[model samples]
Target: MKTTITPRVRTLVLLFLAVVGMLFAGAGTASAHAALTGSDPSSGVVVNKAPTQVSLTFSEKVATNNDSLRVLDPKGKRVDVGKPSNISGTTYATQIRSGLPDGTYTVAWQVVSADSHPVGGAFTFSIGSPSKTTVSAAAEQDVGGGLVGGLYGFGRYMSYAGFIVMVGGAAFVLACWQRGAGVRALQRLVVSGWVSLTAATLWLLLLRGSYTTSGKFGDIFDLNLLGQVLQTKTGASLVSRLLLLAAAALFIAVLFGAYDKREDEEKRDLTFGLAIGGGVVAAGLAASWALSEHASTGLQPGIAMPVDVVHLLAVAAWLGGLTALLVSLYRAPADNPVGRATVQRFSRLAFGSVVALVATGIYQSWRQLGSWSAFTDTGYGQLLLVKIGLVALLVGIASISRRWTGRLADSDTDTAKAETVVEETAAAEEHEPEKEHVTASAKTGGSSAASGDPKRAAQLARQQVAVDTTRQKRLRDADPNLFGLRRSVLAEAAVAVVVLAVTTALTTTEPGRTEEDAKAAKASSSSSSSSSSGALTLDMSFDTGGKDGKGIIRVDIDPARVGGNEMHVYVQRPNGRAFDVPEVKVAFTLAAKKIGPLPVTPDRITTGHWAANGIQIPMAGDWKISVTVRTSDIDQTTVDKNAQIG
Candidate 1:
């Protein structure tokens, strides 16, 4: 005996494998929705004096709570003193304790992007000099803690899957196959969709707080955390979804119970009402996402939100309906096989959904990308390209399904005509006289007329058996058109699963426009900082042979140009505090011109500060600036840098 896999089992296997593959592919890296642009004292930069506050600038606006920002000193102690705030457009700041000890400190921040996704990261900056940080390496993990990120991603995927299934399944029953409501398989599909969405919404709401702030697993269950989540836009949208689901439940109940039981004529009247009511509920559900996610916060949000809702509804109707159709084909009762008209109607619906998807997708792509280069430059854009390719493949398969649908429709029409002709002839024969029946007995091959003669009746019995065998053979062989359509639809559905997964991943990725804007903002901030200081400063780290020789050297050349200039040098130990060294030396040479190696002797102004006035540079060119430091009589090292003197 051999075991064979059925179409239904194959479909399940495909879906399971696709889901597992998607999860495994993305497990190693989960991108953040908001990107950090710049930070004050900048990561790895050292300041002479401790600043009163630490500020960060992001690519987009972000929501903050009390614990959104934190600072840890060299000793891994909390040093921040106030709540983080939006001090300016896209810039947030938090005050730190005054007179912080000179050492490298870590800034850890987590906040909700305008799109309602949580993003967090950590970077280190020094007060007086770079130090060996004591903060745990985990502080720099930018994604929501690994487990939390994975769970959140799973919830997001489920929400999308649920919306498509529920909305699409209901739409198919209402628009394509009114009788589908009575199909148990379809009924389960729609109900499972609702349950999945409801559960996912609850999960996201519970986890939002922890995901945005601490990334701690234990924080997800803290009841107090719910309060904070509810205050945010994402929370509000989730609550709205639950309310809408209540309305959806009523819709589902009416569709499968009362509507299924109604007479065909009665259903016609109720369908108009149900369609209107269901459409509104579906749009509302779509709006719940549009109001909180990427569409609500991006450029032209007023337009984008409505477009996004349309996009989502189109996806549900197309992909979700494909799933429903596939199930009905494979699992509908043999007595009530899926009709050709139903498939044709869905073909029309899917076409319309595709039109809407394309229109809305173009607008969304423009809104998020802002430029052509972003298509290849950003993760969000790259993922979108992958989705586009998958959708194209799905559409190609749908075309094959449409052709098969057309053939099935034609076959059904011919079969119906032949059946009608057979019925009319049978009725005519029943009304004919006995003489007419006897006259036509040879051609009609009727058992009744031949029963009068033993030989004729025996001959008729054999002929009847042969005719019945032929009819059974035809019935045993499935319709080729229907089989082809089912196969094409299956392929479409399989591709749809992968497309949906990519779509879920897109939601968490930072848009290309946002990433570009962040880079621009960082450049502008750096330029402003450099202009304000009015000095060409070079910072370098050095280590001598001595036990405590690791430290940073800051060389500042005021109005660094050809001819006369003033130079200042400061040294600090790894703990970031100013420290004295055995000796320090500085010199410069214009390597391009083979100029002299000019030596500048600087007198010590303080323990770690030294200065040289009226230092001369003979020409403006790339000059090699070398600094040598001696920590002990035998422990000395030299470092070099090339700088423009003009």
Candidate 2:
């Protein structure tokens, strides 16, 4: 069978693979993802006695330092049991020191997962040994042990693994797989894609029940679990697309293999076509998982979806393709000319693929890094960096193979042998010109010969031994080529393992969430428990567009009278911090004491919050104010004030 294995075809295939492979490799190196597993004093379980400690379990390891779990008894009482630790490789436990005695107790815990996700959950436990007790909603809300804490932990790990594999696999194809060569490359891709697709299906099925029940059995026919996973806002969109792509890859695979019976060349082309098709499918699945995780975290779906999708597709190709390349080389038929051609083609393509991977990876790193501290302080970012390091190492290895290693030279073995012989001959000839070198070597040898005390003959022998030792040492230090291929392969594989582990970490983390948590805490503290100005219930009332055609202000100060008109009121800023104002100067549009000697007074009601009783409003519209307070310790300041009067 005639095969048109043109250089152009190989180049084209390599170009295509390179772009996609790098992207996939970049996406698989993050790990900071931890979700809640199960908690003790289980949800909806009414206990007669107050348990001493509240315990929770996680699917993976958790950082022991700076992470905590607390259980609050009824009436907002702190009843946390004990210190939380990762006793087992996978489980994290915390003891409840003070015994819990309550109508309902809530266990609110926050901790760092193996991947660095600070996962938290709350559950309620009842106390007081009684004959019969029932778990009620009121009791649940008081301490509200959430239903999802433990189950989410397991789901999180599973999803993390799935994403890393899918992304890593795609990266492998993009960065490592050779196009227009290797009859089996395509078959391997197809096989991998089919397996992942099948796994997704099974996972969704189990997820259907787990979503509803927190966790599910690890078996087939988990229709209920599958249904729930399929029903979720993000899950439905992601899983549906993956399934479609998987089916398509299978069809492409059949077409490729079908031509194998007709001709040998046909089989080679089929292999190339099939591999490309499989990479596409694998990329699709990787993207689905990446985007879905972003969506789950409540980010704007519009931005998160595309950023993550693109990120995953690129990563999957690089990692998956690389793996495929490694596997092919390990098992390829040594004598097959076609296979050898494919290997060479793949090596060429890998360079380009790595470039693309770096570009996309940089973009992703910038987006998810959020802050510089995340690189060193956050678990997720560290894992991602490790992955990147491994990738760089892998690229280094590839470069050596392609450029420095004799394998890629046009006349590899011959060139190496020639170079070695020439070098040896030059060394022998240079013994005289390098007189100082030879003389020094001879002196060292003479000293050693003295220990033997065998006259001039032994001294000469010692000189030769010294020279040989120096040469051998230099060779060992400067040349790795002397080592067998097996050593090189082992070194590369060791590096690969480190990279894979980092990829696992990145999969679990929610890109970046540490910044978000801080912002959220600040917001919760500042925002009003309800509306502050809506349907004013307090004594103070302000009218906008009032009688004077300006702002009118009213002050209904509710405070225990101090000296003149002292009132203590809590002043809160929008960001949830206490604020103070000096002597207030009120006016219609703006506030200044220049126009009139404004009669206003500002005093600290409680240490921070400032208040004014019977403050005057000059105009009718929405009156604005500037309260200025003077003090010895701190300089006096004025703050913007607003009041509406009818």
Candidate 3:
């Protein structure tokens, strides 16, 4: 028999297609996580004179506290004269004192993205000539590390898991599996989800305090630190989530009768009110996550934040419902009518949720990754691809469950039709016999024992045939499709857990835009280094063991422009004695440009002296020059020096 598509099913299918079409139609330009895009005086650049101020530009508006931006001289002394000023929406600048010395300076900066996440980095620029100082880049402030960091990540994961369980479980009870509403196992799942979310939120608050303060485990309970964090937007978001959880607890208690021994069927009005109120609270809770995450900072916050909330809810509903379905399948009888009905209902609900999830995910991907290249080039984009692949697999598994549901529906239809046939046959046999008896009475003018014998026998035979047919239908081999569906749903739920973990990790990664910008800056700096005029000189020291353990190796690159150049090196002992080595060689590499370590075999001009002409400098940047000397077969040592091409 052909299956008829009900009007309700058609409506749902239309809605699903419409939403999907709208998502594809509204696809827009991509964006990325907030990151530094450009800066004044540019990193690794050589300026003719000291800049009076340094400016940093980010891809999005950011927030910062005092000391968020600083400039340090070659000697590691702070040179920035005052606190940074927000020159524009995404630009921050800090002034430096006039008449500064001509030396390399490092710019260190840390700021909070609009969404409340902290980002920081450091780079160097030179005034006049590059110096030989060993000042390292500014180190990032530790938010949390080791055990604390692990715990924080775990807490975040728990929060996500809890949301899916609580929201999804409650939705399943109200919509699909109403018969299982009062079951203790289902009730515990909801209660556990609620408790987990509340505890995770509170734990995160304390961890955030320690993260922003001293990055020490001991500071987790610091009252002052907690007070400071509570003043920030992140703190406010967490607090709001806690409040929503509290309200949800009340809704779950009253609506589901979680605390009562008996079902509260008399309070239908109260149940309805609690449901509507609970939905509002749940939405508010989702909004809290959006407010403190990448959605609020990266792209069009007005649109991205709301879409993120929807995306989160849809994921919870689908995955959470799957979890509930698995539990129901395990506990209920294989052929239970209620269990079968609940599975069919949940299948429909999950289909709708999946459509919504896909739509929102597409929009989010566009907002976060600006270009196609980012998909392979950036870590964030790579992780997103993995998530997409996993979701596709999950969808494939869900299709199997859907197929099984259809089979089950068909089986039910066949059984109902057989029962109807049996009922009709019995009704016909009763009425036919009565009519035959009336005819016989009229013909014989008196009651007869064998009245209408043939007709009665035919009627009885037809009734027996109907009874046999009904029994055959009832005895048909049981379908194993429901068992198969239960297994498929279980598989989907397992995969969903992995997806959630990946999502949590993605949130903490640097945005692709920042990584791309950093790569571009490095390439630009290398290109500029090759275009300068002047010879480059570098001093290196080597320990060759024995009496001549300490020796000085000096290199000279005449007119050290890119392409061919003459290179020379001199070696001397610490006491000004000529360090005579049997063989000496020089190797050069420009790592930033991925240039090779080209060996330059210089001729021994004199003792402790070497020279080579036609040495290729290649494209410049900071090149590492290594000088190797062999005093004996077993006593050889190499020393390295940085040769600034400019």
Candidate 4:
């Protein structure tokens, strides 16, 4: 005889099949955003002579065109001879024209990272000496500001949400609860997931083009920009995601279509094939995201990438199945046997998914944050910690749901027992009259009791029926643990949404390892500072008026003891208020070495502040500095001060 399958045993089988399917399906490479690792003539460095070229090195290979790198002189003019060229795979270099004058020059660079995300920044370097030029390079603006960034993050969250709902919901319907196959709400959820992912991917592509090029909202639909974006890795990944979504939709339709009309045995074979196909598509879609995110560009990507795919699948399964289970609870009756079975099966599946999620999460954390301090020091690490905390909270809520599930099982058993007793009592009542009449005769005298027995038997039969009705009613009214379970599951799903949002933000953030490396580099450079690169600040007073004419002149020289120095002059009136002069110039003279009158014209910054760049201090000596302030072009006064240069 063929053995009948029990609900509990079937649940276990389905869980096993789901886990196996995910493991086999999630095997693909991952990618991440790039970071700058090092640069020649580091920011704020004082060099004895100007270098012929400027080079910027990144942690990954970069893609660039003509406008990728720019070098600006103290006067804010482009000094780079030509377009930047990629050197040795990772470095981008731009040549400087010969006869470049000594002064502070700013390098502004922008390039597409290996993952096809554009990254740019600006830094300054001094040649011969730092100048008081007020024309500093403009800082790169954040793409589209907070609103755009938030929209991008929202798109990512929606994509994640949709993936979980569609994939996990389909898996739940096929593997765990076939009854849900026809549920309109569950089917809608799957469709909604597909739509969300597709729409979000398209939206992100447009946003990314604008983001990378710093274009305005009007440029979002520009064909040239769109084509350029499509050529990039990120764009290709997004396109692949859409293709996978289409394939998934067809496969889901086939699976459901087969189930809607097939016999039980046929459904088994069809669902098995669907599972295999769906798993492949799911993994491919996940890989598309990983190929353009932090996992791909991060440390040990060979290991981290596949791990991320597993992590994503696990999350989708647990959270997505939770949503399906909640829907089942809402639509099905409180004592619905199918609903109870679904809850139980999903609970088991979720437990396994949580285990996978935790394991993969720990590994990813280790890969992203190599040291303990990074957890406290880096934004990425801190955000990860927040996500972990939320996951733990979700687990706690799930535990409550599990407890309620156990109670539901007990409730089901009691209800079943009561139902069985009702059936047996009803069957025995069919022959009750004869048995009752005989017992009545035995209790009294035979013929006298039989004459009145008919009326009494009818009355007793009515009373018996009343008692049975009451018993059945009480049993039916007992609670089935549905309300509590529904509430808990809802809470769990809410927190899961929050976790997804945080995860989306995490992908955009810089990894802790990169941040730590940058810090270490900064520290090393600062430690190598010497007297030639020392900074100094000085104060002097100029008598511009006859009697009470006392204007304070404050000079700030960065790397004051070196070949190149930046001079910032601040003038204040006799009443300690800022003094605005039309033209403020500084003339330097080295008397001991017989160097005389190196007049420097500084750009006027604001009313009381003046800056001069490329103030070349030829050698180490005592230099006399004269500050000339032209109050009205006619009314001018000079102040003298001495500075020791090394």
Ranking by TM-score: 1, 4, 3, 2
Segments of candidate 1 deviating more than 4 angstroms:
1-11, 24-29, 410-477, 521-646
Candidate 4 weakest ten by summed lDDT: 23-32
Q: Model 1: number of clashes?
A: 0
Ranked by lDDT from best down, the candidates are 1, 4, 3, 2
TM-score of each: 0.72, 0.47, 0.62, 0.66
Writing each residue's lDDT as its tens digit, candidate 4 over 1-646 gives: 1111244335544653453333223311112245555577777877777888999866567777666788888888888887788876566899988788888888877776665555677778898999865455474444333345445555666788789888888878876787677767677778888888889989888877666665466767888888988998888999899889889889768756757578777788777778899889988988997787767864677887899899989988898888777666554432333445667788888989999998998898987776677788888889888888999999999999988887775535655855675676556654688645544544454344368766665665565555544444433334456556766876786677677767766776667766655554343334332333377665554544332233567777777865787889888753345877777888889998899788988898898999977778889887888888777645677766566777
Which candidate comes out best when scored by lDDT? 1
| Top TM-score hit | 1
What is the per-residue lDDT of model 2 for residues 305-384, given as tens digits with 9 covering 90 to 100?
55666555554444444545544443333222113234455555555556666766765665555556667666667767
C-alpha root-mean-square deviation, each candidate: 15.4, 18.9, 20.5, 19.1
- Checking candidate 1 for backbone clashes, the offending pairs are none
Q: What does the lDDT read for residue 322 in candidate 1? A: 93
Query: Which residue window of length 10 is worst by lDDT in model 2?
Result: 541-550
* Candidate 1 lDDT tens digits, 1-646: 1112275567667785677566645654455667676677576667778999999877669998887888998778899987898897777999988878888899988787889877777878887777888784656654564677777778888899999999999999999998888999999999999999999999998888777766678999988888978988889999999999999999999999999999999999999999999999999999999999899885778899999999999999999999999888766654456778899899999999999999999999988887677889888889899999999999999988988888875536645644554565446546767434444554555555555666775665665554434332233225666667777887888888888888887887888776765554444334421312556776655656454565567788988877789899888753356869868899998877898688877889999998899998888877878889888888988766566677
In angstroms, give how far residue 420 of model 3 lies from its true place: 23
lDDT of 2 at 345: 52
